[model samples]
Target: MVYCGPLSKACLPCRRRKLRCDLRTDACTQCTRAQLTCSGYRDTTALRFRHETNAVQQRVTARKSTTTIPRSPPLSIYCQARDIFYHNYVFGPSKPFEFLLSVYSQTSKDVHLSRSVDAVALAYLNAQRPSGSAELEARRSYVSALQYTSRALQEPHLAKQDSTILAILLLDLYEKITTRAPAFHGAWATHLDGALALVKLRGDEQFIEPSIRGMLIRLSTNVLISCVTSRRPVLDDLVSLRHTIAAHSLTPPDPKWRESDLVIEFAKLRHNIDTRVLADENEVTFALIELDSKFLELSRQVPPTWQYVTIQVATKSIHHYESHHHIHPAEHVCQMWNTFRATRILLNELVRSRCMDRQGRVNAGSGFQGIHERATRAIKQMATDICASLPQYIHGPSTFDLTGSPSASSDLGSGTFPAGRPDPRYHLPCYRLIYPLFVAAQSSVVPPSLSKWVVDQLRFMADYHAIKNAMTVANLLESGQRTDVGKVYAMLGSYAFVC
Candidate 1:
């Protein structure tokens, strides 16, 4: 037999076993003779460290001498921006849903998605520093993202991918957080429209992956809420998705599922109420009544764990406040309850408004008055509950000195939350209450003092959280008050208030 060479390369199994490999082209000869499977040779091209000998040291020195030295540290702006976006927005305190981090990490390789992430991150950074170059960079990335997204959309194969859908969602968020103007408002709506269409195109396949399903559900909820708050008609495709979700309720219970189900039902009911009021559809009144009943049932069906349980303690207080009631639940649960109560108030108001006499005038009869009273009571209670659920920092004993401390409840009513470093409790995961707070503030039924407190909270959010929309809502509330628009809906006009 002709000698090939000395055995420098050995099969992995033989090398690990520290046995002679008898290097062969395919299976090693020794392994073959022993009837052992050969795992083939290890790759020698990969970079690795080894004990340095004289030869290695000399070679390394030679290479070091040949290579050029860098002048500055490597730039990681893109990585930094991505991390900021993920932590501050995707996993922020106000986000109620848990996004699968792996989904973003994996799909971040897509050009459109990466550009979108950069765009949003830059926009948020710009919000923190208004006169920065971040805005210019954000605009550039946004333009690039739009171009890539358009190109992706032109390709049927890429458009249906989850990454493209995620890119669209990010673009929508960018629009929302970047600026607050009448002109920019429709940009988000347009992105939302495209996202919903893509989700529809995916159909059941979207639900096959849990992460994708969650994303689609969130998108649907956003769209539904937008339509309701903007006084727009609910899309038929979204209604179909709602029906699908309702049918799947028999499946195992999930918090996300319950939330999506609740929001969809609420949207449908709100749309129906709006429709009935505008069209004077006497024929739709029965359907509206049925929807109201179903909404109540859905509220009851909210997972018991998600419900807020209030606790009352009798205390001999040294402070001036009369009531000493405290609600104990995760902030998100409290917010959900507030939303439920607010929606009920809206429903009641809508019904009362539609109950007109045959002369096409508002009914001031006993029935209308009773409903009006109930709606007023609901709005006041909702306002109280919203304030009660605020972080302890907003209405805690720490707000005043111990010598002659004011009651926490009084402190809340006065719109005085101590100003200093925020309490760690404020950093806790909680749903953003801006929408509910705005709703309560604009309710004619709520006392002006309580509404002022709500407005203060909105201003606090704008200053503290860098949420631009909070400032917008506060401005809207101020203008509404000045204009004597008694109802929040009246003040909103065609503009949608979304969280």
Candidate 2:
């Protein structure tokens, strides 16, 4: 026997119960109190090694695999949708949505913001994969968002919060993505109306915060577009918000903000003509001339960096539309040019249609002939420019198969692109093109050949992007129903400002 160490000084009863012992000669106090036999402590002289080598070998054997297979935790549906939402809308290639970066950072802590984001994200995903359970989840989240937003609105402290307003805006986007037909546009319009009310409730103080001020500007643009499509007057509140933003800012406004001002001017002028508030055709023509010149000035005022090079591709090339497509320095610049072209096309059409006499002849006046001739040229040229911008979008990487072979004849627009869906990054450029392309295709002045190409692009968007709204508008255009631009605008309205 080898003496290792001292045994416990306590009696067995005390040690068994985990209590200290007095080690009385007759019996320990703990044993006496329990009336139990004291199991004597072990003799320190008797010590032995008891462990076998097998345990150590077994432990080491468990670690002897060829390699460690790393595992990543699966992300929840909500997290996946949130990431997709931010990628396409907040961080995507559109200038109007860049402001969202300031607000989305706070989303995690706020239920309304997070749920609203989830709603839109899931709805957008469902738009691409209509058969998924994401649609059901999207509806649930949307209702939850609506309930939370309503509760927030009742509290004055929460009503004007940036997250609250952003939730409302996102709910609007959810409506746009999930609703298939333009007939349900009232769903989104109701959201915008609620957002405008919330915006007005903030008063002039809303401009103090940069994030809230940006939301105000974006909301104003949306409202103005709504007014333009609906033939309603530009709201006095939108004008007030614009002036307040300008008054609060220290530096000069950027070119995009100036574009908003121009849009406001057009919206107001449109209202006046429709309501016949300006009964004088001469006065309307004068306003048109002034607005046209202002637009021309804006075109010149944009920075050289914003300008794009127009690349001329060969007619035989698959990328060729009207024998050319634009190569914008960035995606946002491409979107802006399309916007400018669309607006100019619509404005010039107004010039051609409104500046006519009862007999349908151009009214003789100062700058009328020049503006009229320019309007004719501008309509055709702007429409063509809008068409020219299509190939860059239609021929994107995901739009073509790896082998570049056409699919079966039974497949419609499916074989044109790879079977694998690209990331959400590729989605927005095509989405942003829809409204502008629709505007171009709808114009009477656009040559039938170019208009046909634009329609084909919309058809491609429907098949390739899985966008039902695009298909709806494409069918309407092919049907030759040009009566209500508002109906067509409704289909793609949500995409117009954001992604």
Candidate 3:
């Protein structure tokens, strides 16, 4: 063989194998020693430029023909559904799950994760446009995901993976999206329990990793919601998990994390009252009062960044509060504030119910009246504030006119949901509004008109948005059964669907 140049001296075999080439005038010693035939090198000048010939022209002509009309490959229905889900939930304004954007890559390697994502995504799409074929496909994907998750759980190595926990959580979300009834003992709660158990199996070490820590916190929140709604006591294991998270976390806990501790206390108090753990009505009222105070204290402690502007909408367009709406610093902050208001509403409602139940009796006293009056005012105010947050969700940030500067509306009376505005930004916030609006509507202290407005919002969510839980809730409100709307929320509107 003849030497071309220094760079081109490598035999084809050495270049292909990525081995260091010995530039020799004859066969390379490296290839010869390996008993391989040394394929000769190409000309250095030829390597610098393309050699256009009949074959190259033919290939180029064929490529140009194929490229003449550029067409994007058509995405499958599953891909479209997944994209829609991400748009409405993951990458949407709410960005319900912070970890999803990062953990999605794991789906490439984890079959359970991919299937679970597809299952829930398809279910979410079907909620938008209910069809038998879409529903059937979603159900099939869900079943397949569940089978994979069940098999994964039996394998210790696979069971410990974060993707496995996410798969379980996604399945839980699918059940919530698809299940219409308010039952808690089936797949919905089971997945929540399974995800928690897996986290517990991982133990304190799990908290050292930020992603696992996030999932742990999410799992705890879901459990707390489920326990409060179902009237079940917070489990001791969860209490331990929260402590471990606090202890093992590398960063200082944020406002929401601290608020979660308060929520846990509130949940525990609610459970105690629900289970008759506090048999005396006065004792329950006192506990409610105490928890409310703590929640308020934490609310005050949150950084100023958590503060929101309450704006008065100038028009009587009727999509929102009669007088005002709120704008928060961030979507998460808005959600946190709404959570605070809703929790206060629920707490105060409990207080009023307990205090009033003991009213006009031998045990009735002036102190009971004071507590009842305080709770009544709180319920009314919180209900109104929750209403104030609605317009920001419905119209989004752009359409909101903060400069209108109208007087604040004291009540949540608003018009029916707006039509012909199908902005994607509105979807997640509307879904989140379900529970708070349900709470406000169900509150005995809210004016009948405001209650009706809240119900109408739910009706719109049910009718226009096609949210099944919203339909169940709307029906429940119209029936005036005084049911636990929170239970409906936790059972049918899983946190998986929300965050």
Candidate 4:
């Protein structure tokens, strides 16, 4: 029998028997006859000493430190993932994440797919998923990977190789299902299949989990919002599932989070949905974005001033993914250029008419004057930063942030050439990105301040007259330019700052 009411200072069986006595975990001497899985009685005062601990351990252990696979990835894919991870930013995809997913689906399976220790197939599958045809392909690929992973887990003789592969697969699953990207049917279906397979994967009876099931639940909550935001499918079911997961997660080991990163992401997603969805009692969308950029404390309160939700989500998502599992170092230089171009488009497309006109008022604050100066400065900084992060062989400077990359690329986005290149004090990569971000970040009170900073930064770059080839940030500020950011942004170091 189970007791639901508050028990006085009663022993185990007394509470179990509905007659109050002492309190404990093991059975009290008096209630052996009650016959139950009796717990002991505890003093009320001891409740104040609340403490929590986790017994779950990190399952990954690199045996020889590195397990080398016979076949490697293409230069393009490697570079793209490396770049994005290093940069720590990405909004969307240049070629549509879906297109990338389609190509990856074909590339990673079959030859790459192994039921062994190699997991390039799983890694590739979880990395990108766009939509429709591409989504289908990606989903299929993920399912294949999951099956292979399960087969490894099922072996009565779980070898080191199998253990390594299975663990890696689980981590990849965790990242794939949890992280936000351009969602499509492919990723969703793949994830759902993986989830189901998780329950059955042992080929026998065994345990399976993704990241933490709790985190997965929280991530699914975000995925639901992703689907809703992207207008995908199953909104009602998705929501119901999230509630069910949350309710279950609150039991047992309970939902746990560290450093608050997961919570912050959840808050961001909730806010996105709150703004997009209509009134519903079960709505889990809402949160506050603190200014420190650390996503301090999240409140469940979602504001009505969410007109900018879509844009904010796009920008932040781009940044977040770009810096992680998305693009390569070489790819990033180009991506940075592309981002600048997007920034220009955003400004020009959104407010072109507001600021400028068929008449000529557009000239007033159209970034025509010395605005390019700021653009130039921003470009120089971004290029230098990009180069420093990459390896000398490919491209990248040496000063890349330590929290950067997975820590293994040798030669990447370094500005210096394997052939020949001028010193930084002389010529530099295109500096046009600065003007664009400035323009993007610009507000009524920010433009002039931005312009001043640009000028100051340019002054720091060196004499515009000395570096004949170097483009000034002010140049980007110019109203008229046929500059297509895609084409012109070939290399991070060869832009407005480059001559």
lDDT of 1: 0.59
Q: Candidate 3: give the clashing pairs.
A: 318-415
Off by over 4 Å in 2: 1-73, 95-110, 180-194, 197-205, 314-316, 355-372, 397-424, 496-499
Q: How high is each candidate's TM-score? A: 0.66, 0.75, 0.77, 0.26
Per-residue alpha-carbon lDDT of model 4 for 366-433, expressed as tens digits? 34333334334443443333322222111223222333442243222332213443233212222332
Candidate RMSDs in Å, in order, are 17.4, 12.3, 15.8, 28.4
Question: Each model's C-alpha lDDT?
Answer: 0.59, 0.71, 0.74, 0.34
Top-scoring candidate (lDDT): 3
Model 3 deviation from the true structure expressed as Cα RMSD, one decimal place = 15.8
lDDT per residue for candidate 1 within 157-223, as digits (tens), equals 9988888887887776676555443322376666777777877787775565656666766677766
Deviation from native of the Cα of residue 278 in model 4, angstroms: 6.4
Backbone clashes under 3 angstroms, per model: 0, 0, 1, 72
Clashing pairs in 1: none
- lDDT (tens digit, per residue) of candidate 3 on 1-499: 2333445557889988888887766788889899999887666765555445776779999999878686899887787788888886667655555567667673378888999998998898887667776788899998899899889989999998888988877776787787665646666666677767777787566676686677777777777666666666777777888888888888888787787788888888877766777888767878888989988898788887878887655555565656667877666787787788888998887777776543533237668778888888998888888887776655444445445332243122344444554555555667777787888888878899888888877776666555667777778888989876656675555564556
Candidate 3 vs. true structure, TM-score: 0.77
The TM-score that candidate 4 achieves is 0.26
Cα lDDT, model 2, residue 336:
69
Q: Give the top-scoring candidate (TM-score).
A: 3
Q: Return the lDDT, model 4, position 165.
A: 30
